[model samples]
Target: MLSESSRPIIESTLQTIAERINDITVIFYRKMFEYHPELMDGMFSRADQAEGIQPRALAGSVPVFASYILANPDSYPDEMLARIAHKHASLGVTADQYEIVYKYLFAAIAENLGDACTPEIAEAWTEVYWLMADVLVKIEKGLYDGQKNDVIHSNFKLVSRKEAGTSVLDMIFEPADSTVMSDAVAGQYVTVIVKTEDGLRQPRQYTLLPSAQNQRRIAVKQNEDGEVSPMLHKLEVGDIIEISNPYGDVVLGGYSDQDSQPLYLFSAGIGIVPMVAFLAELKKNHSKRSVVAVHADSSSEAWPLREEYLKLVAELDDAKAISFLKDGEGDFQGEVRVESLDMPRLASVYMCGPLSYMQSVRSALVQQGIPGRNIQYEIFGPDQWILRATRRSMRGNRV
Candidate 1:
């Protein structure tokens, strides 16, 4: 909750701060990285920093959070906070790091705002920052406590590697030590940490695919321009790597309580990773719910886990699968035509793909009278969904 004394101050200056938030964040990252260059080695992504995506995400989130708290002072944004906390837990973020971030973030704000940032304004913003930071710290602590082991990363030896689809490698790994492995739920992800040739450690998160209890499986799409995926693709069968415990809020069976509701799973290209896991879990449980699996790709040959995806759906009595291929044989051609599908408006939808693809599909669903709350999405990298949604809402209000 925001302090009563600071609420009016924040309300008065929020527009001014919001206008310069992007500039403030850019300065903040520059000053922080200049002072502590080691953060780039493992914790933060240099590519995202260079592209300015990280700063934009931070800039968008602070004002959104402030607005939310102002409107509803008794509660925080649980979904947004959980998503952030899960990602932080996967990367082993510590409470002390929040202090380091505060030092540079406020310094940037002071530097940018100049004479307009009075002592009272700075104090109010400080309270807001700490309030948000404290909530994240608490949530991350709970996630860490729920893990099977106290360590952030554990050694895993590669057991097998096979090509699942075009440019996608299916790798299986087993614990190299006696570290207890947590039971991973479907749709969760694990962070893989590897050392580059330059002796710098880089961490990347990959969704955990279905496998045996003692084995961990992940399908990695080799990104030619990525810092980590290329190295992951070159690993031999007997190689060792570090992996974090599985952590994600999106799961196969826990999103809603309506067990008999129609379930729709949508994916595109390498986004089929989590959809496959969800199908495998449902097959294992013999779920009788009405299930529709939809996928889109450039070609049927380019779809990762195509056969396995269809096979699982085939085994289920009340399930069916469809594909939309741009240049090859499928049930439909071109991009996903969500309007043409015969799905119930009340069905639960889980979508994973590129952000633009998901946004288009979501718009189609909304036009068909489907409730926005019924749809859930997972982003593979830094999430800008909330920021984008906030912009959309602001635009709608103006109209």
Candidate 2:
């Protein structure tokens, strides 16, 4: 619903904004930490700051905001927002902290844009920023409400930890106070907050492994490249880490008419986490649903929850697991190209993975004349590219 009248001005302003991304993010983070240092404990990783990952990620979100404002205002995807909510939820981030972020963000923009930002330009960008913040606020509000009645950090205790298949660690969280850990859908994840040796707090999200509702388990693969995952790998059985209530949009649909439609779930690497959760739900409800669950990993060693996924697919009469690489596997019968999807019969498609893979899958579906409403996916990183994609796609649709 982006108005034709304002679209040109919005796009023109965005060109300048995208160019000053690094400066904006750098100044914004500096000011944010200066005013609110406590947030640094759980939210921003010191290691990532030293290595420049957090700054780069924030810089990348600029274009994403532009694309969203310039294109379909009626629709905003929940994937990126959900990831942030879960990350924030893990560390118990609050609305007050988000307000702090907003102040620094706008202040930095004003400083960086300087005289080049005229009244119209300033107003337009302000509208865009508020719109983006509003979306985030609504999402954050949902997370707050969801966890309102739940206990914090005391229900689950770390039971055991061991390397599962190589990079992934199979860590079990047993109920300490309540035998009923919230029933986690297969594809959903939980945020684990651990106290680092430097006394800085760090949070990381991991996909839950298959288990009865009473026992909550997750596959913690060594994120050698990330700050929190490495710390997570070092934890022991008796160690207690704060667990956030599970929050994700990738869960199974409600028991409506839509539940019976043909469902296709796609995942790459750790993206398979949520897919497993969805499959488990499908079984418990005795769903007569038709599903095609596919996972792509480098090899069997990286195929997290291999046995569990296979077990669910086997029992479900209509489900199948399309594996890219098996045990000592060489190759597949055919490369898992998105172009091969039978879009006409598909009710909905859920996908999670690298952006390139999702983009390819999105393109394939769009090329086959599938409606945008039928396609869904998630991203774990900043989402400025989403705006770029929307702008390009909308312009192409008009032509």
Using TM-score as the measure, the top candidate is: 1
Worst 10 residues of 2 by lDDT: 326-335
**Tens digit of per-residue lDDT, candidate 2, span 168-242:** 777888766653355555566676777877787766566676775556788776767777778777877777677
Candidate 2 stretches with Cα past 4 Å from truth are: 1-12, 46-87, 118-124, 148-155, 175-183, 254-260, 326-335, 338-347, 364-372, 381-399
lDDT on C-alpha atoms for all candidate structures: 0.87, 0.67
lDDT for each residue of candidate 1 in 23-84, tens digit (9 for 90 to 100): 99889998998998887776777667778876777656777778778777787877778888
Clash-forming residue pairs, model 2: 64-384, 67-387, 185-277, 186-276, 186-277, 187-274, 187-277
- Which ranges in model 1 have alpha carbons more than 4 Å from their true place? 255-258, 390-399
TM-score of each: 0.95, 0.81
